[model samples]
Target chain A: MIRPIHAIQIFLIVAVITLVGNWVGMQQINPVDAALGMLILVAMVMAGWWLARVLPVPFPPIVFVSLLGILLTMPWTPGSEWIVSHTTQVNFLATTTPVLAFAGISIGKDLDKFAELGWRIIVVALVVFTGTFLGSAVIAQAMLRLTGQI
Target chain B: MAENEVVEREFEHNWKLYGIVLILTIIGELIGVRTFQVGPGTALLLPMLYALVIGMFLGPKFVKVVSEKDMSDASPLIVLSVLILVAKLGTTIGPNVPQLIGAGPALLMQEFGNLGTLILAMPVAVLLGFKREAIGATFSNAREGALAIIGDVYGLDSPEGRGVLGVYICGTIFGAIYNGIMSGFIASLNIFHPMAIGMASGVGSASMMSAAGGAAAAAIPEAADTILTFAAASNLVTSATGLYMMIFISIPLANLYLRILTGGRE
Candidate 1:
C-alpha cells in the first residue's frame, strides 16, 4: 500500500496532468472547470482511502471510492446536480491518459519477467484477453436481444 | 549524506517519473484523438495510447531514461492514479442508476463471459506445452485479486502461482493497449449494440476498462455517456463479485477442463 502522503502527492500530480489533458483534448471543457472537477475526484479518492483504512471492512479503497462517487451524485443528493455538472468538464478519456502513462512507465521493471515467460504464455495471455472480451460481448448481445434492449 | 542517501535518491527517482509522465500527458493530449480506416472498420487511437507508447520508449531496456528502480517506484503510482479514473467512472453511474438497474440481468450474466478465457486459452496453453501453469494463466485475467486467489490456494512458488504471476505481468504491460485497439475494432464492426460493448468492456481491470470503455465510446460517439456508465457499472460488479466467481466456478472448471483436455497425460 502507498503511504497516504505519497498517494496524495501522486493524486495531485495526476490531477494536474489530467487537467492539462482535458484542456488540450476537450475543447468543450474549460481548464478551470476541469481542475475543480479533478479536485472533487481527488478528494473522493482520498476520502475513500481514509475510509478504507479506518473501517473494519476489508474491501479495497476502490470500493469505497466508487461508492462515495455514487452516493455524492445520486440525483437525490443535495449537490448532485453541481457535482455532476462540474465533473462533466473532465472527460473520462482525458483522465485515462495520465493513468496509462503511469502504467507504461511502470512496465519496465516487469519486462524481464515478461520475456522469461516465453512466447506461449504471451499467446495464452492474448487469447485470454480476447476470449474474455468476445465472450462477454456475445453473451451481452444475446441477453440484450432476448430482453429486447438492443 | 543527510540522514539517508537511499531515501533521497528514491525521492529523486519518483519526481523524475512524475516529470516524465507529465510531459507525456501533454504531448499525448496535444496529438489528441485519431481515427483510421482499417478496411471496413475504424481504429480509434486516443491520447492515452500515445502516452503509453512513449512511456514504454523511456523503459530501461529502451531509451534507458528510467532505471529499474524508477520503474518499480512508478508501480504504486499507477494504482494511485487509477483511483481518480475510478472515481470519475463511478460518478457516471449515479445519474444513470435506473438504466444500470434496467440492464441488471444482462450485466450479471455477462460475467460468465470471463470463463471464456479458461475455455479458450487453457487448451491452447496445454498444446503449447504448459503444464499445471495452464490452470493459473487461463483461469482468469489474473489481476491483483486473481493473484491473491492463486497465492492463497497454490502459493506463489507453485507452477500455478508462476502462471498467474506471468499473466499478471503481461496484463500490466500490454492489457490496456490490446483492449483499446480491440474494443474499437469490435465496436466498429457494428454487430453488437453499443450497450453490449459497454458491458463487455468491464473485463475486471481498471486500466483495461478505461481503454476498452474509451474505445467503445469513441466508436459509438452517439451513445458515449451511456456506454461509459454501463462499463463502469459492469466493472464494479465484476470487481465486487469476481473473487467469489473465481474461487467457486473458474478454478474448478479450469481444472476440470484441463483434465478433460490432457486425459491425465504427463
Candidate 2:
C-alpha cells in the first residue's frame, strides 16, 4: 500500500518547513532562532516517520533536507575570526570523526548477517559499488570531453 | 498480543547494555572529533561499526535491545557532531558567497551525478534477486533507521519496514561509491591543485563539499575564490540534497525496478 506519491508529499512538506524555518530564524533573536531551528528539524524528522507509517515515504531525504536547512540558517557572528579559522575547523573535525568511524565499524560488524543474506548482499554490494564508480566516471568523462578539458 | 508482550519485556530488560554501548560510542566519537582530526564523513563510520558489532554480538536476540532510551541518549551526540561539521562549513562559506552562485549549476550537476549512481545501482540489486525483506532490515538498522527502531518498538516490524531497510542499505553503499568517483573526477580536471588520489578518496568520503572545496581552494586559492565558495555550498547541499534525493527518488526507483525485475515478487 505504500505509494511513491506519498514520498513526494513528504518531501514537499519537509522542504517547506525547512524553508520557513530558515526564513524565520534569520529574522529572530540568535539563541531563540537556534533553538527553534532545532525544533523545526525534530518536527520534520517526526513528520517523516509518521508519514512512513501512513504511507511509504523514505526517511533519509527528510532528515538530510531538514539538517541542511538548519545548517543554512544557523546564527554566525561576523567578527569571530578565531572561531572560523581553518585550525579550528580541523579541530572540530578531529573531535567528530571518531564517532563517525565508530558508527561505520559498528555497521560493518553486522556484515556477518549481511554476509549470511548470502552472496546476494555481496553481489549487490559489488554491483552497486561497481555501478556507482562506472556511472560517475562515465558522466565525468563525458562532461570533460564536451568541455574539451579532457 | 503475546508476541508484543514478549518483545516489550525483552526490550525493557536489555535496555542497559544498549545504553552502555551508545554512551561509550558517543563519548569516543566526541573525543575523536574534539582532539583528533577525524572529519564528519569519517566520524559517522564509528557508530555505524559499533552498531554492527553490537548487532553481531547480540545477534538477532538483541534487536529489541536497541530501545527508545538508547536513541534518545544517542540523539544529542548525533546532533552535536553534525553541528560541528556545519560550523566548519559555515566558516568556509562566510568568506565567499558570490562565487558559490556562479558555480551553482556545476555543483548541482555534481549532485545529480551522485543521484544518478543510486538510481542505477538500486534496480540492478533488486533485479538480481535481493530479497525485499533483507533490504528493509538493512535500511531500518542503518543511521536513518533510528526512526525505524521506534517503529520496531511499536511492533510494526512488517514487510514494508524490511523493504525500506534493504533499499536504504543499497543506497548507502552507492552513496559512498559516488563520493569516491566524483572526488577522483574533480582531481583529474585540474580545476584546482591536485592531491593524491587516496587523499581525494578520503576527502570524497570525509566531507564531500569541503573535500571538493578544499581541493579547489588548494589548487588556485586566489582566482577560484568561487571554488571555495562552491565547495562550502556543495558540502551542505550534498549532505542535505543527497539524502532527500535518495529517499524521494531512489527508494521508489528501486521498488519499481524490483517489480519489473522479479515480476512483482516483492
Candidate 3:
C-alpha cells in the first residue's frame, strides 16, 4: 500500500496531467473547474484510502472510493448536482492517460520475464483477453435482448 | 514474488519518472482522438494509446533512458494512480442508477462471462502441453487479485504461481492496448449493443476497463453515457465480488476443466 502522503502527492501530479489531457485531448474546460474536480476526486480517494487503513476489515481502498463516489453523486444526495457537474469537467479518458503512461514505463522491467514465457503464453494471453471480453459482451447482449432492454 | 513486495517498492519517488510521463501525456493529448475505418469496424485511437505506446519506447529495454529501478518505482504508482479513474467511473454510475438497476440481471450475470477464459483458453493451454500452469493462466484474467489468489493457494515460487504471474505481466504489458483496439472493433461491428460491450469492459483491471469502455463509447458516441455507466457499474461489481467468485468458482472450474481436457495425462 502507498503511504497516504505519497498517494496524495501522486494524485495531485496525475490530476495536473489529466487536466491538460482533458483540455487538449477532450475539451477546453475551464482550468479552475477541472482542478476543482480533480481535487474533489483526490480527496475522495484519500478519504477512502484512510478508511481502508483504519478500518478493521481488509477491503481495498478502491471499493470505498467507488462507494463514496456513488453515494455522493446520487440524485437524492445533498450537493450532488455540484459534485456531478464539477466531476463532469474531468473526462474519464483524460484521467486514464497518465495511468497507462505509467503502465507503459513500468513494462521494461518485465520484458526479460515476458520474453522467457515465449510464444505460447502470448497466444494464450491474447485468447484469454478475447474470450473474457467477447463472452461477457455476448451474454449481456442476449440477456438485454431477452429482457427487452436493448 | 509476493504481491506486497511487487507493490511496496522502495519509495524513491523520482522526478524523472514524473517528468517523462508528463511530456508523453502532453504529446499524446495533442494528437487527441483519431479514427479510421477498418473493414466493418472503426479503430478509435485515443491519447491514452499514444501515451502508452510512446512510453514503452522510453522504457529501459527500448531506449535505456530510464533505469530498472525507475521502472520498479513506477509500478506501485500505476495502481495508486488508477484510483482516480475508478472514482471517476463510479461518479458516472450515480446519475444512471436507475438504468443500472433496470439492467441489473445482465450486469450480475455478465460476470460469469469472465469464466469464458477457462472455457476457451484452458483447452488451448492444455493442448499446448502445460500442466499446473494451465490452471493458473486460464482461471481468470490474472489481475492483481488473481495474483494474490494464486500466490496464496500455490505459493509464488511454484509452477502454478508462475503461470498466473505470466498472465499478470501480459496484462500489465499489453492488456490496455488490446482492450482499446478490440473494444472499438467489436463495438463497430454492430452485432451487440453498446451497453453490452460496456458491461463486458469490466474485465477486472482499471486500465483495461478504461480503454475498453472508452474505446467502445467512442465507437458509438451517441450512446457514450449509457455505455460508460454500464462499464463502471459492471467493473465495480467485478472489483467487489470478483475475488470470491474466483476462489469458489473460477479456480476450481478451471482445474476441473484442465483435468478433463488433459485426460489426466499430467
Candidate 4:
C-alpha cells in the first residue's frame, strides 16, 4: 500500500515533474523564469483545489482552474498579458505528453472491472460512440449552415 | 513530535512512487511524440492514443511494470499537467474571441450527443433485457456527472448504480479513443466548419476534448489556435451543464423509456 502523503509533498512532486517536462521541450528557458512559471501553475492548482473544496457540487479541480485562468487571462482583463507571457514559456505540448501518458495508465487500472462486465459492454460502447459522433455531426451541420460559414 | 517524523517518512515514500510514474509517463510520451514526426499517413500517433496504448499494454495485466497503485499515485501529476495545458489552451483564446463568439450553440451540440444515443440505444438495451441497473448505464451519460445522480435516484445497491459504473468505466476508456477519431474524421470531411467541428470536440472529458480539438487544429493549420480555444470553452460548457443533464433530463427520460418498454412495469 502507498503511504499517505502531505498535500505539500504532492504539490512538490507535481511541480518538479511538470518543470522537468517543460524544460525537456522548452528551448532557451531562463531557469529563474521557468521556476516562476512553475510557481504560477502551482498557485493555479491550489486555487482550483480550494474552489473544488468550497463548492457545493463535485466540481473537478482542473476545470475550475482552467475556467479561472480563462477569466483572468481574457484579453480585456488586467492580468491577461502576464498570463499569456508566462504560459508561453511553459511549452503546453510538453505537458500534454505526460498528461495523456498518465491518463492511459490510469484508465487501464479498471480493466479487470471493465472486463467483468461482459461482451455487452462492448456493444454499448460502440453504440454510444456512434450516437455521439453522428449527433455531433448532425448538430454541427445545422449550426454551420445557420452561420452560413460552410 | 513523533507524528511529524511519520508524516515525513510517508512523504518520502509518496515521492518515490510518484517518481516511478514520471519515468513511465516520459517513456509513453516519447513514443507518442515520435509518431507525430513520422510520415504523413502516420499523423495518427498523437500522444493521447499512443500514451494510452502504452499504458494499457504495459500495465498490471501484462508486463506488470506499471501497477494500478502507481497509476493512482500519479493521478495528481496527470491532473496538474492537464490543468496547465488547459490553462495554456485558455490563454490562446484571447485572439480568437470573435471566432469563438461565432461558434454559438455548436459548441454545446456534442454534449447533447448523449441524448441522441439514449433515444436510439435505450430500446435496444431494453429489448436485450438489461436490468434496471444496466438501464442506468445504458441510458445515462455514465461519466462522473451521472454516477451520483444515478446512485442517488435509485440507490447504489440498485441495478441503476451498478449499470452506471459499468458504462462509466467503458466510457472512460473508449471516450478518449472516440474523441481522437472524431477530431480527425471531422477535420478531414471539409464539409463542416473547422470552428464548428472544434466546438463539437468538447464532449466533457478534458483529455478527450483536448485530443479531439488538438487533432482538428493540427489538421487544419489555418485555425489551429482558434480551434484549441473554442474546444476548451466548449468542454467547460459541457461540464457545467453535464450534471443537470444527467439528473433532471437524462434520468427522467430514461425511466420513461424503460416504463414504455415494460408496459408500465417497475
Candidate 5:
C-alpha cells in the first residue's frame, strides 16, 4: 500500500525511531522515554502496513524505511553512535522467523494454483540464480581488479 | 446469510489459524537458532527454510484446522518482518560505510548483473515454449515490486501475468532459502569480495537480502558492516531502477527474442 504519501509518513515514523533508538543505545532511555520507544515500534508497524498498499513505482516499503534509517544514523552526524548501537535492538532474527513461517503457509494455500504453472519454475529459478551469480561475479572481480581492492 | 457475511464471520474468529502459525514460527525459530560451526569462523542455520518446510507440511492434506482464508493475515505480518529487517540492516551500515567512491562502479555492475538475470532467463523460458507473456514474466522474478509492473502493463490475466505470478510464488518459497545458501557458498569460495556478493544478494527479497548479508557477515566478521552496506545500497538502486528498466530496456529485448523464436508472430 506504500503510495507516495504513505511512504513519506512511514519513513518519518521509522526515521524518528532510528533517531531515538540510536540515541538510547548510545546513552540510556529513562523510564518516561520508554513509552515513546514503544510508540515508535507501533508506528513502525503501522507504517509498515502502509507498505501493503503498493507504491506507484513498485518499490517496496523496505527500501524507503532503510533509506530513512540510514539517513537518521549517518556516522558523521552530531550523534550517530546511538543509532548504530540500538540498531541491534531491532532483533532481526526474532522478527523474520515468524514472518518466514507465515510466508510458507501463505504459499501452501496456493499449492493447487501453483501446480498448474508447470515445471519451468525449476529451470527459471536456477537460471535467474546463475545469471545473477555470473553477472555479479564478473562485475565484482573486474571492479576489485580495477580498484586494486582484490 | 449472504456469502460475503459468512466469509467475514469465518474470518472474524480464526483463532486456530494464529495458534497454528505461532507453533510454526516457534518451530522455525528453534531451527534458525541452531547454528553449527562449519569452520573456525563460519556457522550455518536456515530458519527461513525450516519455517517454510514445516508450514508446507501443515497444508490441507495434513492439517485443515487452518484455511488459506484464515492465514490471510500473514501477508502484513510478513511485510512487517521485512520492514524490521531492512531498517535493522540500515543501522548496520551508516557508520561502517566504506569508501563511497569505490561503491559507485560496483553498484553499477551489480545492477547490470541483476538485469543480466532477465537477459539469461528470457532465452531459457522461450526455449521451453513460453510465449511473450510467460517469457516476460519468467524474465523477472517480479517478487514484490515487479508484480505491480506485470499487473499494470500486462493484465494479470495475460500469459505474462500467469508467468510472473508463478515465478513470484516459487521465489516466495525458495528465493530466500537459495539466496542464503548461495551467499554462504559464494563466501566460502573466497573468490569474490564479500562486498560484491552482498550486492548480489540484494537482487532478491528482504529476507533473502538479510540471509545473504548474514552469510557474508558470518563468514567474514570484519567486513560484516561493509557487506551489509553494499547489499542495502545495491538493493535500493536495483529496486528503484528495476521498474523502468524492466519496462523500457528488458521488455523490448525480450520481445526481440520472442519475435525471433516465434517466427515474427510476437
Candidate 6:
C-alpha cells in the first residue's frame, strides 16, 4: 500500500522534474517550457492515477497539488510568457464559465426532483446559505472591531 | 464478468453525454462573453446548470450511463480550465500580497469561527426532515454545473472529475459567504477603508469584491487606494483560505445538515 510518505516522494519527484525541465528548456527553444509544463501535468496525472490504484489511503493530495502547481506556474516559467498571456485569458474562460453554466443547467434539469422534495430542499438550501452568510458576517464584524478596522 | 462489462459500458456511455455537454458549454461561454460582456467564469454557470438538469433527467440511469473513463477524462480539463482562469485573473488584478496576508488570518479564523453555529444548525435542519438524495443531488448538481464545460472540453468524466466539480462549487459558495459576511461587518465598523472592504470581499469571491468596491466607490470615491488595497488583501485571503475552509467546514456542515434532515437516509 502506498503511504502518505510515498505521495510526498512522488510530489517531490514531479517538482524536481518540472524544475529541471524548466531550467534546461529555458536555455533552448522558446516553446520548450510550455511543452515541459504540459509534460509535468501529464506526469502528475499519471502519478495520481497510479497512487489511487496502489494506495490504501483515500487518495494522494500530493498528486493533485503537484499537477495544480505545475499548471498554475507554467505561465510564469521562462519562454512561455506569450502563450501565458494569450492562453491565460482563454484558459480562465475555459474553466470558470463552464462551471457556472453547468451549475445553472444542472439545477434546472433537477427541477422536478427538487420539486418532489419541494420546500424542504429549498428551505434547507436557503437556511444553510443564509446561515453561512450571517455567521461569516457576524464573525467578520467582530474581528474587524477587535482589529480596529471598523 | 457481465457486471464488470456493464460497468465499463456504462462508463463509456456517460462519456458520450459528457462530450455533448462540453460542446454546448463552449458555445454557451463564447456567446455569453461575446454578447453579454459577462466574464467566462460567470458565463460558465449556464452550461453547468444545463448539464445538471440533464443528469437529473437521466436520473439513476446516469450512474449506468457514465463510465469510469468518461469521468477520468473530464477531470484534467476542469483542472486546466481553473488554472487558466486563475492566471488570467492574476494578471487583471495584479499582485496584492500584503492584502492577502492581512486578511489571511481573519479569513482562516472565520472558517472555524462558526463551528458552534453549524453544529447547532445541522440538528435544526435535521429535525425539520430534509431529503438526503435531494441534498446529494443539489450538491452533485451544483458541482456538475461548474465543471461540466471544462470536463466536456477535455473529455474528462471520471469520479475524479466529479469530485473536483463538487469541491469547486462548495468552495466557491463557502468562500462567498465567508467573505460577504466579513465585508459587511467590516463596513459597519465605519472605518471607511476600502482596504478593509476589499479584504472582506476578496476573502469571498470576485463578484463580492466588485459589489463591495461599487458600494465603497459610491460612498466615497476619493478612497480608491483603500478600496484597491482592500481588494488586494481580501483577494489573497480568499485564495489562501478558499479550499481549506471548504474542506474542513463547508462540506462537513452540509453533509451533517443533510444527514439530520434526511434522518440518516443518506
Highest-scoring model, TM-score: 3
lDDT of 4 by residue, B1-266 (tens): 11222334333335554565466545544553432322222333443345445655557778687766565554444434455555555555454454555546656555676576677767666665675755676665465445444533553324564466566656655566666766777688787677666667776666667778877888888988877886787766665556556655777787888888888885
Model 4, C-alpha of B261: deviation from truth (Å)? 9.1
TM-score of chain B of 4: 0.56
Worst 10 residues of 5 chain A by lDDT: A17-26
Give the residue spans of candidate 3 off by over 4 A.
A115-126, A129-150, B2-10, B104-107, B125-266
> Across residues B59-105, which tens digit of lDDT does each residue of candidate 3 receive?
66588878876776666666667778768876876766655566578
**lDDT (10s digit) by residue, model 1, range B1-266:** 11122334444336787888888898989998776655434445678778876776687678998887666666556556777877887787677665556657999899998898887899889998888889889999887556545644654435775588677767766778788888988999999898889989999887789889998899899989978988887887676557668877898898888889999763
lDDT per residue for candidate 2 within B210-230, as digits (tens), equals 443454444454534644543
Off by over 4 Å in 2: A1-115, A140-150, B1-18, B21-48, B59-100, B133-204, B207-237
Segments in model 6 whose C-alpha atoms lie over 4 Å from true places: A1-57, A60-67, A70-89, A96-111, A115-130, A145-150, B1-15, B34-104, B113-129, B133-198, B216-228, B256-266
Better candidate number, 3 or 6, judged by TM-score:
3
| TM-score for candidate 1, residues paired by index | 0.67
> In model 5, what are the clashing residue pairs, if there are any?
A1-A51, A1-A52, A1-A53, A1-A54, A22-A82, A22-A83, B133-B160
lDDT (Cα, tens digit) per residue for candidate 5, span B76-150: 334434455455555555564543334577676666676567667877877776775445455565654454445
Superposition error at B237 for model 3 (Å):
8.0
Q: Clash pairs of candidate 4?
A: B133-B159, B133-B160
Task: For residue B215, give model 5's deviation from the true position in Å.
Answer: 14
- lDDT per residue as tens, model 5, A39-62: 444444345445535456555455
Clashing pairs in 3: none
Candidate 6 lDDT over B174-200, as tens digits, reads 423333444455465665344434443
Whole-model alpha-carbon lDDT for candidate 2? 0.38
What digit string (tens of lDDT, one per residue) describes model 4 on residues A28-141?
A: 787567777667766766676668667997655545665565666667788767866776677655555555555556546655654455777656655655565456656766
Clashing pairs in 1: none
Model 5 DockQ, alpha carbons vs. true complex = 0.31
